[model samples]
Target: MKQSEIKNLSLEDLRDKLAESQKQLTDMRMAHAITPLENPLQLRAARKVVARLLTAITEREQESLVENGK
Candidate 1:
């Protein structure tokens, strides 16, 4: 997913996507370990997506804390 698209998602939506992406990354790793993926690049892509999602979520949380003076 593009950063712009991710940026538009609500906090709850971002959380859901982050969870789904993490599961996909785990599944991809397990499958790859058992047998090489036809496209190993899929693993790399998934990892990057997970990282992006996590980063976005963290940024959002930090922003909220700052705004609330927490």
Candidate 2:
């Protein structure tokens, strides 16, 4: 998923996507542990995507907090 696409998503949608993405990443790692994956690099890529999503979520939350003066 691209950063631009994620940025367009609402907070709730982003949270849902984050949960789904984490599950997928975990599953991929577990499967790879039992047997080498066809593309081992996928794990790294997935981690980066999760990081991007988290970053966006955090930024959104901060913006909301600032707007509300909390």
Candidate 3:
């Protein structure tokens, strides 16, 4: 997913997506263990997407905290 699209997702949606992505990553790893994937780069791409989503979430939360002065 693109960073812009990910950032547009609501907090709940982002959390759900994160869970789903993690599950997919686990499945991919298991599959790879049995037999290497045709495109192992999928794992790397997925990881980067997760990281992007997380960064957006953290930044939003931090912005909220700063705005609230808490």
Best by TM-score: 2
Residue 25 CA displacement from its true place in model 1, Å: 0.7
Residue range 1-70, candidate 1, lDDT tens digits: 9899999999999999999999999999999999999999999999999999999999999999999995
Ranking by lDDT, best first?
2, 1, 3
What is the Å distance of residue 38 in model 2 from its true position? 0.4
Clashing pairs in 1: none
Displacement of the residue 64 alpha carbon in candidate 2, Å: 0.4
Cα-based RMSD of the predictions, in order? 1.1, 1.0, 1.3
Model 2, residue 23: displacement in angstroms? 0.1
Model 1, which residues run further than 4 Å from truth?
A: none
lDDT of 1: 0.95
User: Whole-model lDDT for model 2 versus the true structure?
Assistant: 0.95
Q: Estimate each model's TM-score.
A: 0.95, 0.96, 0.89
Superposed by TM-score, candidate 2 places the C-alpha of residue 52 at a distance from the truth, in angstroms, of: 0.5
Q: How do the residues 1-70 of candidate 3 rate in per-residue lDDT, one tens digit apiece? A: 8987986898778888888888888999899999999999999998887888788778878888999996
Clashing pairs in 3: none
